[model samples]
Target: MDGRRSDTRERIRAVAMELFTERGYEKTSLREIAERLGVTKAALYYHFRTKEDIVASLSDDLRRGIDDIVSWADATPAGPERAQEILTRYGALLHGLGRDMVRFWHENQPAFRELGFGVGLRYQFRVLADLMTAPEHAPLAVFHARQALLALSWSISMMGDLPLDDDECYGAASAIASDILRRM
Candidate 1:
């Protein structure tokens, strides 16, 4: 029963994101989300009070996922293997966030910033970079690390129109990430 309730919440979020991406975030509303989900506005309200709540919910989930990576990286010994693991874990996390959130995040950056999701995510990313190039912190090494992380992230949103599928892109991006760490 609890699992089904959790599923209903996820379904609501998925429908809300579809509406948000189809019609810009500012243009989507709770009524439209409920209608699209074939539920009453009150039922939708049981989970999310506003459109911002929906976005916030997804962002919160993402933040928690990144937080887990950061915590693990902190506890793990500082080494290249740990860096690779961090990148791999982050890749898996972004993949689970769904393509719609990726599209919505790219297409709705200003709104996400306005809602304050950008700061926490940006900070978490910096922690990952630090984990990747800790102790020495050579400028060039840090640069490559940042670029590698960027490529891993871009695999989620920017490669949608490309010929490759999700696994192909993510696998390639992660390989590039490993090579970058090797160089450092």
Candidate 2:
């Protein structure tokens, strides 16, 4: 029963994300999500009362995923090798979370901003980037670290129109990120 309930929640999230991406978040409605899932609105309500709830749930998952990476990186020694590994793991996490959400974020920046998730996510990213280039913390090193992280993130987002699969995109992004870190 627990597993089934979890699956329903996941389905709702996936469908909601798709709807939110297609029609702007403000334009998407709970009824539309329920209709898309071929489920009753009450059933959808049992899991998420509002569209904001769905987005908040997804944002929580993303935050937890990033937190895990940041915690792991914090425990490891800071250096080029660790930096490379961090970028790889980060890329993998984003890939695992599905590229659609990343693309959604890129498209729905205003929605994220209104929800206050944009600022929090940005702060967390800068902190993670700083940690990746810790100890030295030189201006150039920080710039490169941010660039390396951006490269990995952009590969998932900017290349959305391309015909490449997630793994292919991640690989190319990881390779480029590795090169950037190596140079740093």
> Of the candidates shown, which would achieve the greatest TM-score relative to the real structure?
2
**Model 2 regions more than 4 Å off:** none
lDDT string, candidate 2, 1-184, tens digits: 9999999999999999899878988899999999999999999999999887898898887788889888988899988777777777778878888888888877888988888888878887887778778878888888888898888888888897899998898899888987887777
Model 1, position 113: C-alpha lDDT score: 92
**Can you tell me which runs of candidate 1 are displaced by over 4 Å?**
none
Model 1 lDDT per residue over 39-105, tens place = 9999999988988888999999988998899899888988788878888898888778876688788
Model 1 weakest lDDT span, ten residues long: 151-160
Q: Lowest-scoring 10 consecutive residues by lDDT in candidate 2? A: 80-89
The number of residue pairs in model 1 that clash at the backbone is 0
lDDT of each: 0.85, 0.86
Clashing pairs in 2: none
Best by lDDT: 2
Q: Per-residue lDDT for 68 in model 2?
A: 85
Q: Give per-residue lDDT, candidate 1, residue 98.
A: 70
